[model samples]
Target: MDSNRLVAGITVLARGSQTLGTAPIPNPADRQHPGDGLEGLPQAVPGAVGLCLSGGGSRALSCAMGQLRALRWLGKLDELFVISSVSGGSWANSLFTYLPEHISDDDFLGQPVLDPSQLSLLIGPHRLDHLPPHNLGEVPTRLGLWRDLDAILTLKERHGYANDELWQGLIGEQVFKPYGLWQPDASGHDPRYFTWTRRYLQGQNGILAHNPGLKPGSFLCVERARPFAIFNTALFSNDGPDADLIPFECNFQLGVRHNFPAQPSQQGAIGGGLLDAFAMGGRYLGEANGGGWVSSGRPARPFALNDIAGCSSAAFAQMLEEQYPVLSGLVPRYPYWPVAERAEQDTLHYRFADGGSLENLGLNALLARGLRRLIVCVNTDQAISRDPASGDIVLSDDLPPLFGLQPFQPGLGYLPYSAQQPGQGAARLYRHNQVFARQAFAQLQAGLFAARQAGGAILFRQRLPVLANDWFDVPAQDSVELLWVYNDFVSSWWKALPFDVRAALELESGGNFPRYNTFTQLELSATLVNALAHLSCWCLASDSTLGNQGGLSNAQMLTSMFD
Candidate 1:
C-alpha cells in the first residue's frame, strides 16, 4: 500500500476538508483507495452511525421528517456520520438542506417538514393560475362525467411533480446555485448546477464562514459525515452481468461507488463504471462517469443536483411506461437537461430509472463505508395505483431481499418482512411491482444456495454479499455487526387525510383530468412514535426517558419485525 502517499493525501484533506476533488487515488499498484478515509472527521470514524431512508413518494418523506424530529428531540442528530436517501426520501432530504434563504432557519426548523398549510397553499387559487399553456402544472379542469376523476388527477399531478421546477418550488429559487440562495438576482444569468455540498459539512468554521448568529450545519435536526444521494441508470446490454443493483453514490461530486457489487472470492479488485475494476474502497473525484480522481481517458462531466433529482425520481420511468410504450417514450425535458453530459447530439439519449429498481431502499453502496448503525426508514405504500371501487391506495412495490446484509445476524431475510409473501390488495395498479421484487430476490437466493451446495459459495458481483466484508459491515456481537432498525410501512399520512378527501383524490376525471394521491403529517408522526419506541433497544434510554413514551418496553421490541 502507498502508506506515505496515503498519509500525505489525508494530511492535506485534514487541512482543507474542501480539497476532495484534489486528492489523488492512493496506490493504484496496491489498489488501496479511500472509502471512510475521510478519517479525522467525526463521522468518518468506523463504527459510527448510518441513517438510511427509502423512497415512497410524499408519504415516505413525511415519515422521515417525523423520525428526524424524534432524533432532534433526543439531541442525537449529530451522532450520525452519514445519511443516505432515494426517491421520495430524497425529496424530503432536499427540503431539509436546500430551503430558501428567504425562509428563516426558525421558520424551517420550528415547523415539521410537511406543513398542512403547504398543502393548503398549493391548493389555493393562485396555484392553477400559475400553470402556463405550455407548462401545465396542476391546473384542475373538469370533464362532464370525469369531473371527479379530473380533480383527482389534477391533484395527483399537483402534488406528484418531478421536474426542474421542483428544485425551485421545494427550496424556492436560487438555493442550489453557487452564487448563493440569498443572491437570487446577484448574477445576470443563474447557473443551474451546484457542487457546494462539501462546503456545508465544515460547520460554522473556515471555508463556509456564516453569520455568527446563524447556526452551523451541525445544529440541524439531522447531521452526518456527508450527505449522499444515490441515482440509478441502466448500463448497455454488454456492460456487466444483468442485475438489479447498479450501485452509485454522490454528494456534489461523486464519492465511492460501483456499477456492480464486490466479489468476495476476488480480493484484489472492486467494481465500478461499465464492468471496470476499481479499488475495494475507491472514490471517483473526477468528472468520470464512475471511477475516482485517477487514470486517463475522457472523463464524464459532473451533473448538477437537478440531474441527480431526475435520476432519483422513480416516477420518471414509471410515468413513461404508463404514458407511452418504453420503446418510443421520451422523458419530457430530460433530453434537454441543462447539466447532462453532451452526447452524439446536443441531447442525452439514454434513460435513467429509479434507484428502487436496484434496491427499494438506497444505501446498497453505503454499506461498504464502515456503517455501524443503519436506521432504515421505508414508506411501503406509495400512491402506485388506484382502487376503482373504494378509491383506496395500493403500495405493492416491495424491494428485493437484501444481499449479505448482516449475514451472521439470523433473520428470515436481510431486510424486514422480505421473506414472506405479501397479503392481498384489491383492484390496484403496480401490484405487480412487489411480485417482481420478490421473484428477483427468490431467484438470487436460489442461485446462492445452489452455489453453496456445489463447491465454494459464488458471491455474485452484481448482488449484495452473502457474507459481510471488512469494507462494509462493522464488528458487533463478536462479528461484523450492523444494528438494523427496520420499519416498512404504508405511512399513516395518507390514511390520516379525511375519508372524503381521499375519495376525492381517487375520483376519476372523465376527459383529460388527472388523479391525485396525497398524505398528511399526522400519519408520519403516529408511525414514527412506534418506530422510535422500537429504537429503545439500541442502548438508548428506557421508555420512561422517551419524551413521548409508549406502553411497550425495550424488551418487547427485541424481536425482528421481519420474523
Candidate 2:
C-alpha cells in the first residue's frame, strides 16, 4: 500500500480546505460555483435539469428503465445535469452510466432500428403477441445468473466475507453482466483481480470509451456524456433524528464533485466531503502526523463497481438479522475537521443500506442543489386494496406514498402529482393537483417563512435539507418546477391500447396492470415487465399539473429545464 502517495493527495485537499477558511460543503446558495474536485467539469446551474429516480426494488428498476427510454427518445438524456437515484432505481442508474457505449445508445430496449423519436411508435398501439423486448443484457438463463453466484461463493470460501459481498457479486453478474465486469477468480488468479476499479469501469479507455473529449491519460475526469450521477445510499446511524424513520446520513457514490452539509440551516457545515471515487474503501488515518486523511493501508483494494451497487441497493440491510446479514458495509467517510474531527480521529466504519431507508424520492439531494427544474420518478406503492363490493383487486387512485409525506412536508412544500393513473378521472386528478399546488404556495406566501418557522425545515440531520427559510435569491416556491411521475397505468396510454391488447394484459396481470408487488415479486414475466416500463414512460411523457399548465405536456415541462 502506497501510504505516502495516499497521504500526499489527502494532504493537498486538507491544506486547500484550510486555506478556504472552512471545511468544504458545496454552498447551496452559490449555484454557479464549481466544487473543489470538480473545478474543470460542467456544474449544474439554477434552472438546470435534474432527474430523480426513487427506490422500490425491481419495480423501480424496470420503471426507471422505461423513463430512461422516454428521455432518450426525447434526446434529453444528454441534456440532464444530474441524475440522483436510490435503491432499485440506482441499479438502473448504474447500468445507464456504465453500459457499453453501443448498448447504452438504444436505451436498453434492445431495438435501435426502430426510431424512438416518434411518440406514436414509441408507445403506440402494439399487438399483445408482440411486445417490445425490454432486455438490459441480463443473464439469459437462470443457470447463468447462478454461475456468478457459484463463483462468488468460491471467492467467499477462499476469503472470508459477508452477505453484502455476495449480493454485490450477484448484481455484477445479473444486473451488470455481459459488460466484461464479471471477472471472478478464474484459474487461481488473485481474488483482488476479481474486483473492478473506478478507473477500469469509467476511465478514458474504459467502457465509457465512447465518450468523446475524455482527458488524455486521466482516470478521474468527469464523464459528461452521461448525466452526473449520485447513487444515494442509507447511512445506518441510530444517533440521527428519528432513527426508526432511518434519518439517512446523506452519503453518495458521486460521479461528479459535490459536498453534503451536515445541517439544513448551515450551508457549509463540513459535515461531509467527497471521498475520491477511487479511494472509497481505503482506511482513514486521523491520528497520523498531520491530521485526518485517507491512507492506503495493508491490502489496499479500491472499491469495486459491484460494491457501490450492492451498498445502494442493500434494502435487506435494514433487517439486522438474516440468514446472511446484509446491513454490514464499509465505505470511507470524510471527517469534519476541528469540530467533529476528534470523534472520527480513529478509523471509521460506517454501515450504509438502501437510500430508501430514509428518503425514497431522491428529491432532497436535487432540492439541496437548488435546481429549479426537477423531474422525480417515484415507484413505491401502498398495499393494494380489494374492493368491498366486488371483492376484486381495486385498481384505481393509489396516491403516491411519498415517504408518508402525501399532503406536504414543511420546508420542501408540496409538488402536485403530475401524472394520472388508470382509475383517476382527469378532472378529479387536476383538482387534487390544484389543491396541493395552492397549499404549497400558501406555505411559501411569507418571505421569511423559513426564518420564522424553525421546525418547518426538512430536518434530516445527516444531510442537507430543503430549509423553509428562503435559501435562494429567487422565491423558493415560485422558482421551482417539479414533475412527479409515479408508477401507474396512465389512463390515456391504457385507452390507446387496442381492446384485445388490454384484455390480454388484464388477464396476464390478473387485473393489476402496473402496480405489481415490489420486494415480494422479484422475478416478473416479460410481459408484465414491459407493461410496467410502458406505463412509466407514458406517465412521464403525458402528465400535466398546475405549474405545468396551458395544456403544455409534461415532456415539454421537463425539456424546458434544459432550455
Candidate 3:
C-alpha cells in the first residue's frame, strides 16, 4: 500500500474514533474495518491486534495495539506515536515494559514516545474559569487552538521529535499557567475523579474497537503505548492591580473548602467551646486564625540569645570582657575596628539602640551557606556615597558585585567572571540566587526536618548604607575604629548566620533578638525552619564539618541532608 494513502486512511479512522461517545463500543466482536469486506476484514487485521485489549483500567496503552491494527487494516501503518501525561506510574510502566522492542521503519504501527510540547498541542488549550462539559463536539472545539495531530506529525517528519525541548517548553508554559485546565481538578475542586473517569472510558473504547484473532498479550502492548491526551481550561482572576500574572503562583487567595456539619449559633458556640476545651487539653491550639486565646493574643516575643548590641564590636568586646574577665586586656589588642572601618567606608550600617544586629537574620544565614558553596551573589544598596574630593556622588555598578566569601570556611572564593562585566556568570548567579531564595522560603513553609529540629526561629533585616562623604578615611583612634568594626560585625554576621541559632537561644533563655521588634513567634518559627534546612545542607557538604567523605549527587545530598 502507498504510505501516504495509508497514513491518510489511518488519520480518518483516528478522527472517527475520537468522535465516538465517551463509552467504549458495546460489542468488540461486531466491529469491521471499512476497506475490509468480510474476507478482507479477517486478513487485513493483524493477528497480534487482538492481543491489545483494555482490561479493567482506563489507560492509553491498553488499546494502543488495537488502534494500530485498525490503522494497518486501513493501510496507514507508517508511524505510531505515544505520548505520556506523566513521567511515571502506570503510564510509564506500560510504555517502557510492554511495547514491542522494534518495528520496521516502514511499518504502519511503529511506536515512538512523544515530547511534552507535542503532547501539549495534542491536548489543546484549557481554561479553568469556564469549564465546558465533556461532550464530543465541545472536545474538538476546545482543542481547536492547538496544533492538530496532523500538523504535529508533519513537524515530527521534518524536525524529528526531541523530548527535552518539548518537555522544557511544556514546563515553562505551566510555570506561567499553573492552574491550567489540563491539570487535575482544573474544572472541579476534585478534578482527579473526572480525569480518572475519562481515562476509563477511553480505555474501554479501545478494547471494543479491537480486532478479533489477536493474542491477549498484544493488548497489553497496545495499552502501554497508546497516547492519551487531556485538555486544561482552568482560569483564575486577581483583584489587585499588582498581583502576579503567573497563575497559582501566589498564596494570597487560594484555598480548598471543606464539608462539615454546622450547628445553630448558640449550639454551634457551645460545640466550638467543647472542641476548644478538648484542643486545649491536647495542646492543639485550634486553627491559627481561630478566635482562640493563643490566636487572639499579641504575637509572642522574638527569639534571641544575645542582646542586639552584642552584635556590635564594642558591645561584643565589652560582653566578652564581662564574661571572661581574663580576656579584658586582650580585647584592646585585636584590631576589630579596622574591619568595622572598612564596613563603614563600604556604607554598611551599625545599630546600637534596640538590639537588632546582622548575625541573626535568616536571609543572611542562607546566603552565608550559599557563599560556602562557592555561589556568587550581589548585595544592592539603594543609596550611594558622595565623593568628598570630587564633590559628587558615585553611583555603584548597575549589577551587584559577583563575589562569594565563606564565613565559617576560612578561604574558599571564586571570581569566575569580573563583577564589572555583568556577563553570563552574573546572569547565572542572579538566577541561581533568586531560585535559591524562593526555594528557601518554600522549604520554611514545608517545615523541613532540620527546621523542626531547630525549634522554629528566623529573622531578617535590611541595611541601607549611604556614604556621607567620598573621602571617608579610616580613623587612627581606637574608638573610631571600633565604630567601623561594629558596622563590619553586623554585615558579616548577617550574611552567614542561620535563624535557628537565635531560635534555639531564645528557647534556652526566654529572650528575644532586640532588632526584630515586631516579628511574631510563628513568623520566627517559619524562618528558622527554612534557615536550618539550608544550613544543614551546607554542614553536610562541608569537609570541615561532618567529615563524611562521599561525593553524592546534588539531588541525593539535598534529600538526605535536608529532606
TM-score of each: 0.46, 0.63, 0.15
- Tally clashing residue pairs in candidate 2: 2
- TM-score, cand. 3: 0.15
CA deviation > 4 Å runs, candidate 3: 1-194, 197-550, 554-563
Taking the tens digit of each residue's C-alpha lDDT, what string does model 2 give over 311-331?
677664333224334333322
Query: In model 1, which range of ten residues has the least summed lDDT?
Result: 4-13
Candidate 2 lDDT at 241 equals 38
lDDT for each residue of candidate 3 in 399-423, tens digit (9 for 90 to 100): 1211121111113122223345323
Worst 10 residues of 3 by lDDT: 480-489
Per-residue lDDT value at 298 in model 3: 13
Q: Each prediction's Cα lDDT score?
A: 0.32, 0.45, 0.19
lDDT of 1 by residue, 392-427 (tens): 222234333343121111223233232353222211
Identify the superior model by TM-score, candidate 2 or candidate 3.
Answer: 2
Clashes of 1: 21
Q: Which candidate is the best by lDDT?
A: 2
| Model 2, global lDDT | 0.45
